[model samples]
Target: MDGSISTSISSSRSSPLRFSHNPPTPRPLLSPTPRLTPASAGRQPSARLRAISPSPSPSPTTPQQRQQEPMEAFGFDALKETFSVDVAAAEARPLNVPLAAPFTIASSRLEAVSNVAVRVELSSGAVGWGEAPVLPSVTAEDQPAALAAVARACELLVAARSAPLGAVLQDVADALPGHAFASARAGVEMAVIDAVANSIRIPLWRLFGGASNTVTTDITIPIVTPNEAAQLAAKYRGQGFQTLKLKVGKNLNSDIEVLKAIRLVHPDCSFILDANEGYTANQAIEVLDRLNEMGVTPVLFEQPVHRDDWEGLREVSIAAMEKYRVAVAADESCRGLLDAQKIIHGNLAHVINIKLAKLGVLGGLEVIDAARKAGIALMIGGMVETRIAMGFAGHLAAGLGCFSFIDLDTPLLLSEDPVYGGYEGILRENPAHLQFPFVNVLLYSYILQL
Candidate 1:
């Protein structure tokens, strides 16, 4: 896909894809690919892109910068104005789920993640569960603020439950604009989507369009000491994980040491180096240049510079590709469709990380479709969330059938599974044949099926 590269399979196995019946787990492979996943397929290039209207345009510097461009309407605003979800009642509670271990990134070291769990009761008494992982660094929403936002969205959901589902979700968006309590909006959207799917007796992936039944995912290793990273890498590899995400971006030397350690232990594993917006332009260049010197070529280089440093982002991306032929993906710099617009228009990255928390389910679909049409590689990721939210994200990613990378490892990282009922099993497992005796057949099928 242009120079925006992502590894993918041609076609899936001929076996009939079943839904909601858990089968015996399949054999794991060194490659984290499903039997028949057409990952990152169905791209539609040459679709005239509707560029976003990013706020506060920069002062003009050249003739091209001063020229006006056509803006494409993404229908998100219309969807918000027509929301309809009959919510009989809605409830929210503070959730402080302790991680099994501390997850360290460049910005913060966290022993526990605080979130808000929501239960939305539909008029038919079908309750859908959702959780919002609140992080100021990621969603600009703290626990208390996200809880309040969820509370407000519940009120709006109750008021407009009779509207269409999209309209009902749109109403929530209208009530909270400009990324206000984004995680909260995301949680509400997911719960409502799950509730609706359960009511209709279908999997969440089918609710979106039934593109695929399973998704393959990679495990993450947070920034840590070389020994710890190498140990974790080998441990994950032994557990059948093929792809590993190395959280880097502090000092160049330490990062190199950690990577070298992992490589020395498990040289055959696939690796993605995520800098988490911790390095400067020059620093990022030096580190990558050094990586090249050390003979390490990661599958992808993610967010090497600060989020707002768009110029530096492009420079690093270009430098990485030109010097080492490595692909670069954007994470922190891409908040929503608008940021995506700026990135694509400016040629900032090879891949864009799409998190459902930032772009609610509907918007996520639209953005992914747009990115695919634009020929940009796509990655579906999640915050450190439980199985509830990330489960839905995994189904959506699989349903889209065009994601290049899958990073739904948050639940694996969580110390406890506070919520369930979404897709949960090994990457090699075909959950469609799995039996669920506890949940209502319809409820379990809808919630658990792909």
Candidate 2:
């Protein structure tokens, strides 16, 4: 309901969607990452990082440093006033986007993700996009349920009271009480926000006060052998990444060995060990103790115990903090504001990882504000989402300049780039409108089947 942004939404649900447990065919990792090309980079000045060197820079890339070169070189102004738009119609666009490679997390192995997207058409004839990656592992909501939730949410927006863009999106979010389809509701919310922000002729960060315009996020390494983990860490390090998130929980000893392998290869890089609720409280404590003996501590220890084991979470967190002086964060345990409150009030976590799927732009902001009020740290994160969702999170992380942690690096794992523009440098406007720079990279054709 903030007056800075304006838009409206809602429509009837879509029909006959299919859900699949089968993973999409994995694409080979061949395409180079999408960066601003001189001809296509917009005519605008990008943000810059404070100080960066060949050596590991603690700060991530800033807005000015986003593009390979500079936006001014191409003369692309992302904020150039396009046209004002009154929301006309909103529709759900679902696609089972294939991953460039198979990604194995603690929960399961995924060859592709079901990306449920929302396309908004405005009165000015400008179409805006918003997307939420559906992953049962993260939000318990799958593709069909997510698409249906967006459809139902859109229907409510059609009849709701009209207001500013932010407010309308908030209303759209409110329509889904108890987060019946939390991620799906978020898709609608983001679509509206994206449309309104773009329509206003400014970056989404500016609408949010444009506090900080740059961010650096940690790339994740799923459970792998110690040797593989080390080799992977070296590759990411060679790519100039300074932080690494290693997935733990399969085997405590093996996880420790993985950490050791990475540490041996890249000693200066910061690390975040995420157990994905794969460990018991005692196991979590034991690992931390063992790591302390190794004399190297992670930047943070995430979700060390089962999602519902509040006592276990608190025990490990407190023990890690008291004994090892290491901070602990809660991911699966903290979904929205209520969980955030419990984490803060109950002192269950030193930090909270706010992923957009679990909390849309608005809901994510509210949670960030709550964490700030309580002096708890935040990590702006997202699923293996394309530029759409990560773009939104990056804006907030850079604008607010508050998150001590960021995990918006999943796109690096993808072999394709499905979105053209959203995040400043992370995803740029590909002048080729007909197709993404990499064919089928950003295009979701399965959406048309509906």
Candidate 3:
């Protein structure tokens, strides 16, 4: 009926198969069956035929194929280009006064925490600040040596055109293989990252991928008499601390009495008992069982026994899980990922507490990842440090969301923190309000001028 149909019909009329005069009596009104080609009639469409075939993939170029890739591609080079530490712009500051006395543990008392402030600057005029309070007994060093080591290392790295922080550390470690101080190394490393992050204007937590913003940290009430411990717990509780970590390792009875006293005032606060490697496996079990009977369930028992006693640790872990339904955490026993791997392979504990001071920041991150992959719960704990170091630890805590507990009470333990407002000082009198005479005028002047 349409012109196109007429054209088709006219064309068909010219062909040999077309009917002429009566159009073959006009076929009965019916739908025409589709004609099938010989190639298609005998076969059904396959799944392979039904699926969409993508265009042929382009072959990789020879240069791309030859490039050697890092095992874990972190976009590290991008980070390096993004932020570089400037060695010459480094600075240091002195605390208002030496930290207060009677810094006691269950086994020993400390007189002072010699504090030094460190700052690392980038070529772009960005600066990162850090604080290192020398803990001679804990880190096996004194204040002067630690400060000198840190300054010397900072100079060495800066003179080398301010290499990537990791490369700088590797170079320093390689150069001073047997002489490296753990505290000094930690101080410098933290300052470097801080400066770099400041230069890039990114929060340290976001740099690690939005793991956490604010984490609830446990406040440690150092070992004291039962009455004193109760007062300290009440003070911290009044100040809005929900979790309390009691130092417990000198005398089991004294520790129990102290725990009982604190419980009387604040029964709802969660507790973590840190023995600091003071008990034997048997002693740990006895103390834990007694605590359980007293109705004070610790969220975790940290380093109940000595560091090297793997057998003791395993036994304690099994006993704690079976008898008290409590979990054991390994602290001093872990040094790196390998240490974590060994402990996990042996089932030494239910959780692993990672200290960035013990394992360098990057190394600590690796260990955390390894522990997570091995199905162990993680805790981020810190040594006694300044707010600068605590900032680094806080970032790590925020990055790793699985951490069940955080022990970042360093600021709460320091008697005087030079940085002041960012963190709460331990002393009743705020250290920022006090001014001290020049104990190190030359160093102070040099840093201030920088």
Candidate 4:
């Protein structure tokens, strides 16, 4: 969790988690299953990626100057020593997938997932995949914009000749900076990093931190009617989903009713209320008060107010923790490292939701490092995406083993799986648990479950 994060490349394996009888269709892979051998008993962990030393340039005197300064590249000397990556080719394309049902939330409604897919091929013939997920009102870019931005970024990546991996990544970040092009930036980063991991013959999880190979997630129930909520809750309970994240904040009365019906159906399940910036400070507190009256307490309340309402966020956070002993999470309010610094210094919320599409991988890592030092909890969520993006996130979450709450379940809501190559036995039988298979064999594709 500190700045000096080292990598663990363990070969010892455990039996795969038992999944349902029905599994997704398996996609072909370019390489065969990877072989592994147990490390020596006394072997020591090696450092892979680490924070780079500060530059010799003069420090900025003003806050605006500091904000405008580029983030220093994380030293990847370990990667360079092991192997060099030459960006042979890259491409981006429209990735549109049908959702199982309409995904309705506080701010937006969607019948399908419109995203951008990115492919990065190394000169060594190793390939990586990424997805830029677009959620209207949440993400800065729509489908067309994401596609165009990613295409431009891919062209830049291809134009670079034998650049260091870190420099190549920094160039992508420079091209797609801030929320305006964060989704595109994240997609390109994912592809680049995944390709690096493949080139070195290791899984992304191992390349990240190797904390754990699996991550448990909570299923989501979007804003819906009381009856529909109850049915979905019951169905998820049967599916062995222990936690349910309810999307609220559109209508107070309707939200309360839906919660009541869901509670009636699945009384034992824990709840996470994600308002998605739908309520005011007072309304957020009132919802908690009513839930307490019904003898129901959510484990967490997410983004109860708008992103810019810092004061309201702090007020709701304090009230939620003091009165109900429930944690408030800042999702929309935290779009960058500056916002993370504000929340940390001002004590705005108990948890910060880390979405790579919003902050990109490097930006997310910087926030995580800062939050860990400040003793704040973390949550990893994502826009509705296919396995390409969600799978990349799952590797980081599992490898870090630091997130308090995991909400990477959007792939389950998709009607069909597009990019797929993973353990076929791993399926939605236990949809809450995500099992990351060996990525070394998956040079061309990757899959992370719901």
Off by over 4 Å in 1: 1-17, 21-84, 427-450
User: Each candidate's lDDT (Cα)?
Assistant: 0.65, 0.61, 0.57, 0.73
Please list the residue runs of candidate 4 whose C-alpha ends up more than 4 Å from where it truly belongs after superposition: 1-77, 80-83, 423-432, 440-442, 446-450
RMSD of each: 11.2, 11.9, 26.6, 11.7
Error of 2 at 356 (Å): 1.6
| Candidate 1 weakest ten by summed lDDT | 51-60
Instruction: Tell me how candidate 3 scores on lDDT.
Output: 0.57
Candidate whose lDDT is highest: 4
Cα distance off (Å), candidate 3, residue 281: 0.9
Model 4, residue 180: distance off in Å is 0.9
Judged by TM-score, which candidate is best?
4
TM-score, structure 2 vs. true: 0.76
TM-score of 3: 0.73
True-structure Cα RMSD, model 4 = 11.7
Taking all chains together, each candidate's TM-score versus the true structure is: 0.79, 0.76, 0.73, 0.82
lDDT (C-alpha) at residue 357 in model 1: 77
Candidate 3: tens digits of C-alpha lDDT, residues 1-450: 111111010101111111011111111212121111000000111122111111111112232442452222233335644444556565445533333335566545665546556677667766666655455544544677767776776677667775665676566555323313655666666676666655554545445643333344667777789999898777766655566788888788889999999999878777888888878899899998898889867767888888889999889888877776667789878866778898888888877888766666666777877877777777777766655576567665653445666676664464543332231112111111000111110111112212
- Cα miss at 184, model 1 (Å)? 0.7
lDDT of 4 by residue, 14-77 (tens): 3433222223334533222211111101111111111111111111124475456443232233
